[model samples]
Target: MSILKLGALRGQLEIKEFLRQRESVVFTLAFPVILLFIFGSVFKNTIAPGVTFSQYFVAGMVASGLVNTGFQQLAIAIPMSRDLGTLKRLRGTPMSPISYFIGKAIVVTASMLFQVALLLGFGALLFGLHLPTSGILWLRFTWLILLGSACSTVLGIAFSSVPKSGRGASAVVSPIVIVLQFLSGVFFVFSDLPKWMQDIAALFPLKWLTQGMRSVFLPSDFAMKEAAHSWELGKTALILVIWLIIGTLLSIRTFKWSEE
Candidate 1:
């Protein structure tokens, strides 16, 4: 079969494997949903004149949630496959390596879409998320999700090299994701963060993703509260594009079919 078609099959298997692991399911998917409630409860007031903190925070969670499904999922999963010698065996198969990466992209994209749908549903039902009605806003939302998924998924595959073994995957990967979420304004207002934190967060794609999401879910005036005092849509798109390229290169350089 063609590599693309094989990749689709691999993606289905990946999703099934992910579902079977209750720990992975809870940590990578459910944890974000739980935090959405915890933070939403503590800061229930309006972030803007009309937008409640729950509403604003939902956008942030959506951004971070994508990171979870994309970055964190592959980061840990790939390493576990390596330590278990799964990748090594797969490498001996007739399947092309690119197909493996393609499978990963599919898994991230599918999981992220479901994740976002759940977040939006929860927000709308309980917190009144108020999704964008404008075509232009929805257009922006579409690209953000596309770019965000590609960026995070490839980066996660590259970052899978960090852990020494499957056992260490979560320990090494989780803290970094947590730190980025806090720094990238997922847990608080971007403008309200320390200047140093703001600058640091801008160095990564998560910050830009959060800002892009905010632009979609919040009013245009809410852009004033961003660190740039503007939505910076152009900048957000550029950063994610750059990172996607860097991540592709890094994954090629770092990818190993075996623990060896």
Candidate 2:
């Protein structure tokens, strides 16, 4: 077979395998919705003196979904694939490593899209969330989703490079993801937190994504009260781009095809 055919086949196989795994689907899609229900219900009529609970929770959900798909899912799966000799087996095949990665990327992107749609649908139909007011606002939401997914996927690959074994992959990855969820303001309003805490959280992409998402969905008047106090689309785009670049470089430098 030609190299192009080989690559396409590899990607198709990867996607098929992903679909066959029920656990992955549950973890990626259901888990986030569960959290949304818990948090959304808890905060439902209890808005902060100044902020609406639904609005706050929506931002947090977007951030949580981004992390779950981009960082948490990739970190565990990639390393386990390496440890199980999947990556090793691929190295001996006719398909280029780049093609193998492209296949994984396609799978990840598809999964992320499904996760996002499911969350949005659940949030709106059952939870009373409204759609964006205009096409421009919806466009911003799209950009945030793409950028957030890219950053998390690269970071997940980078982290996978260091996991000790397939068995330990979730152990190492989940803690970071869970911790970041709390720190990323997924469960609480960051503005209500102490100043230093907010400062530290700003260093991560989660904060940018959640805040950017809020800017898109919330009223323009609300943006004026944000910490950044403005949409700052350029900053959001820049931060995600930098993280994607850094994560890509690190993964390329550190990733191994085998348990080396």
Candidate 3:
């Protein structure tokens, strides 16, 4: 088969396998909604006067979905696949590593998009969130989503390179994801966070992604008022691109097709 057709088939199969896992389905679609209900209810009338709680939560929810699919899933699954000899076996086939990566990327990207849609739909129907009216706002959202996905995918591969075994994969990734969720303003408003915490969070890609997304969904007049207030789209894209490059280099240099 042609490379394009082969990659498409492999991607479809990977997506199907991911969908077959009940826990994955629940976490991807339901977990964010549950969080929305909890947070939206508790903070309903308490968020800053100009900011609607639902509108504020939508950006964070989308960020969470990106993390779940791009970082959490890939970090755990790639190592497991390697440990199970899948990567080694695939390497021996006519399928190139590039094709394998293409398939994997397609599966994860598709899954993330679905998760974003579900979060947006849930936020709209239940919490009365509305879409951004400006086309430029959507353009920013699209840029942030794609950049965040690329950054997360690379970082996931980099982390997968260090895991001693497939069994420890989730153990390592879960804490990092949880910490990021907190620091990235998914659970708390960045402006209310301690200055030190904001400084530390600024070092991570997650913060930039969350802030960039918030700029899109939040009112144009809304400003972070914290160190992260200014959303430098060019700078954000550059940082993600750097992470992507570093991750790519690390993956090439350190990744092992089979358990060592």
Candidate 4:
């Protein structure tokens, strides 16, 4: 079969397997939503005119949810698959490696999109969050999701090589995600963070992703309040695209079909 068709078939299989993982479904997917309620309620001060901390936190969580779905999910899944010999078996089959990635992409994209919808729904219901007021902002939001998804997926694939065994996958990957979330302003205001923390997070894509996402949900008036004192969306896109290239290269170089 053609690579595209084969990839679609693999994606279907992946969805079925993911559905069967009750813990992954309940916790992996639900953790962010849980955080939304806990953190959103505590930080109720205003960030901008008519924008509350709960609303800001909700917006940042959408970006964080994307990272969880695309990066954290794939990074853990691929390493486990390698240790379990799934990729080893695929190597002997006629399936192109690209097909496997296509399958993973379908999974993360679907999961992240659902996550965005869920977060936005709850954000509106509880925090009075609203969608972008202009078509241009909506356009920006759409691209950020797309570019962010692509960047996160490739980075996840590359990072999968870090954990030596399936048993240690979560142990190794969890801290990285947690730290990035904190430093990248997903859980706090970027400008309010220590200057050193802001500098460190600025070196990574999550910080820019959070900023881009925040700009989408919040008003332009608030851009002046950002660490950069402006959205710097052009910088965000540049950083994400750069990481996408770097991640693709790293995955190609380090990706292994088996533990060997």
- Between prediction 1 and prediction 2, the one with superior lDDT is 1
**CA error at residue 56 for candidate 3, angstroms:** 1.7
Candidate 3 per-residue lDDT over residues 92-189, each given as its tens digit: 89986666666777888898998888888888888777678888988888888888887787777778877778899899888999998898788888
| Pairs with steric clashes in candidate 1 | none
Model 2 score (lDDT)? 0.78
When sorted by lDDT, best at the front, the candidate numbers are 1, 4, 3, 2
Q: Lowest summed lDDT over 10 consecutive residues: which window, candidate 3?
A: 220-229
TM-score of each: 0.97, 0.92, 0.93, 0.97
- Model 3 gets an lDDT of 0.81
Measured with C-alpha atoms, the lDDT of residue 136 in candidate 2 is 89
Q: Residues 163-216, candidate 4: write the lDDT tens digits.
A: 898789889988999999999988887788999999999888889888998899
- Model 3 lDDT at residue 143: 80
Which residue pairs in candidate 3 collide? none
Give me the overall lDDT of model 1.
Answer: 0.89
After superposing candidate 3 on the true structure, give the runs of residues whose Cα lies further than 4 Å from its correct spot: 1-5, 224-228
Candidate 1 lDDT by residue in tens digits, 180-249: 9999988888888999999999999999999899999998898877777899999899999999999999
